[model samples]
Target: MPKPTVKVWMEEGVHSAIFAQQAVVGVFKLPQVTCLCCAIGLPPVHPNVHSTQKGRLLMSSITSTQVVSLSSQAPRPLPFWRRWLRKIEWRLLLLPVIGLLLWQGWVLLAESGYYADFIVPHPDTVWARLQERWADGSLVTHIATTLREALSGLFIASLIATALGYIIARVKIFDYLLTPYLIFLQAIPIIAISPLIIIWFGSGLASKVVIAAMITWFPMMIATIVGIRNVSTNLREMMRANAATHWQIFRHLEIPSAMPELLGGLKIAVTLSVVGAAVGEFVSAREGLGYLVMYGRGISDTPTVVLAVLMLTVVSLVLYSLVAMLETSLLSWRKAGKP
Candidate 1:
């Protein structure tokens, strides 16, 4: 029996064609043969031996009909516009596009004083207040304080949660001991025990950082656990069959396989850290964005309150963006997995 031969073809680095050609003549036969390559699963370029240019070229150019043409002269390397189109197909623009549109709508609505009751004030008024606060340096101080606490909390939470998650996923004893308590913590709202946190740690940076950590920990924990546990069983078996040590299995296979989930958890942690910091400041703090908001609300300065809220939102967005950028950098291997 003659073995099958494959001709792999590419056009501008994109998979263009895969041809299966036979070497022996009438001794062996292939029934219902079909070309296996196309750009993103479209119909094969050469279906019949006489239909398209690809088919005509294949049939007329080859004396034996046993030969197959993988592609047509490397396809001219694709035009610039076509390359751009391919890139567009490769990347996702949906979430950012929707977010920008929503942001624009919010700006327009805020300026129009449409939801001017207790929710949001006019955008111009908010902007004016922002400028005034900026000039006085209080806004900058507030933003800095809040961001410091949020980042501190996020760092602590990510470290602890990721470590614990890896432990619980890999160690049955740790999972038994800690999983239920972690779940309980996740279920409990930080707002419900604000008084306790303030009483224990005081209305200082410590309390704020702790609050942020508490809020951010659960999601990271859950994501890490799922990710670590979700490594393909076949891959695990392969590693074990090769007599790989436990550490080797984890370092080589488990960590990389679970990275997507870990990054996902980190992204959630980033947004939650901002919210936690603000909530802590809102409940009990001398300085920070939440304190500004509390101060504005106390005096019925709706515009100032609106400005603080907007600033907090911008902070969350910035943190989330940073996390997303980090995720992309760390998980370049998952580009095909990304939508």
Candidate 2:
């Protein structure tokens, strides 16, 4: 009997090799090589592959393995739920762990009198400020105020942008008419024009909402326009052939088709809306995280400033995550369509 020839293939991103045993028939007249493969979500199977025949080589048979679960032994896979949780845990911890270590290092240096507390600010100082603000009920007020402004602006901007984008995309005359004005608006930086907006809108909730809307509208509008334009011509023609009304066509075909681009724009717009709200607050506001940051800066309170900025970041992340969750929920159909 001849010795068995071993063949191995590497799996990408997985630290495992697929090993196959190839037995050659010489004196005894054995048939072919037996290869064991671990199938996804299924039990392993042994396949007999022959390389010699009357004139050609071919696959002979696939059978059950008497033993050897390569998956269980070599590359162990967790249950889907466990894998999901582990992934989330890893992603969530990786950043904060690194950040806390760096921050603590800085804190240690600052506490040792090498760096001034005013400049670096101990992590404890920031935590103390957070607790102080929370105890006084002021933290909730600022957070709520900011959320109201950002969400309001985001909603208003999304509505106007989505509506106008459709018109600009579908109607040539509207596109022509809107182009020059859109160009003018695009040329003017929102920050540069923000003071004017504050002046015009008179420094209230309305002004903040307007500023946020102004800042947020462009990206979503562009996305909607692109999404609408990118809709398949065949789908449009099919709808027309079926005598579908414009409303029906838009609701059924266009909405689903354009969802991906719209969601992408929305994710960006959500973050920008928070910035816009903060910008509005910076220009003029009685209360907000931005106001807290400004107030801290004026008084040289590094801890307060850091705390406010952290809260603002948390707000942005929360809003961004909500949009992401919504996108995932709504876009499952897209995944279903994949072959």
Candidate 3:
């Protein structure tokens, strides 16, 4: 038998394109065929050579049982747009593609003299600045500083907020006393009091972490209080009726019920933590992206500013994604249990 060449083709209604086995599958004789529409249990039809005589013969020889088996093995392909909608890769690319197009258009207009170049430097200019900073090794240190502050702040806030919120929600008396204090805290602008915080904590990592924690604590506290308090009354009673202890009830019932709100708060907290870290760095910092922003502005370096902003945006996105991923993994049971 001649060693056969095989081409893979899309089948109707499938989310993904699949290739046939390159080697012959005993009686299946996959390698003898030029195309594999029959392998996907479809009639021999191709946009190209998939509809050749060999494909038709392969399809014709299949018994009804084998056809059903093959069909069951692969879904029919969806139309191109449907395929895009069904998968994340293209949809995620869409916005970035549009943004890049708009940016390039602006760059073209600036180059054509419709807009001043100083208004915003070209993407090339920004890329050059990023490369320079990366090569100098400053970019990593700044990002690490900011990330360390933000993550540390978020961690501290989560522990304190969860414990305090639980106490307030369960005890009720502390709800009135502590909730008012948190409201007062949130009401105060972080910038207005940052100087005092910096003075107290010093112009170091301590101040940055304190500022980030202050910015993050209120929302997470609210989320924790709301989530714990919102546990189903029926569930509480049912647990009591079953003589479940407080620990078991909290572990099994309250935590699961409150997960949605807690996660919601965490999403908000993570982003705010980034903002707080930046604000702290803005007010007083030796290094970090915030420092880069200030340094760029001082020197009228648009590319440097933009690059720093983009890195900050990337950091914000990373923190948010981590929370989103955590939410998906933790609360997947709710989705799975849905009818």
Give each prediction's root-mean-square deviation over alpha carbons: 9.9, 12.8, 11.9
**Candidate 2 per-residue C-alpha lDDT over 138-211 given as tens digits, one digit per residue, 9 for 90 to 100:** 99999988889999999999999999999999999999999789868878898888889889997778998998
Record all residue pairs in model 2 with backbone atoms less than 3 Å apart, i.e. clashing: none
lDDT tens string, model 1, 6-82?
A: 33333335443433445332221222123233332333433433223232213222223343344554344467798
Q: Residue 295: error of model 3 in Å?
A: 1.0
Q: Return the lDDT, model 2, position 160.
A: 95
* Residue 187 of model 3, lDDT score: 99
Of 1 and 2, the candidate ranking higher by lDDT:
2
Q: Rank the candidates by lDDT, best first.
A: 3, 2, 1
Superposed model 1: Cα runs more than 4 Å off: 1-120, 337-339
Candidate 1 is scored at a TM of: 0.67
Residue 112 in model 3: lDDT:
81
Question: How well does each candidate superpose onto the true structure, as a TM-score?
Answer: 0.67, 0.73, 0.72
Q: What value of lDDT does candidate 1 attain over all alpha carbons?
A: 0.76
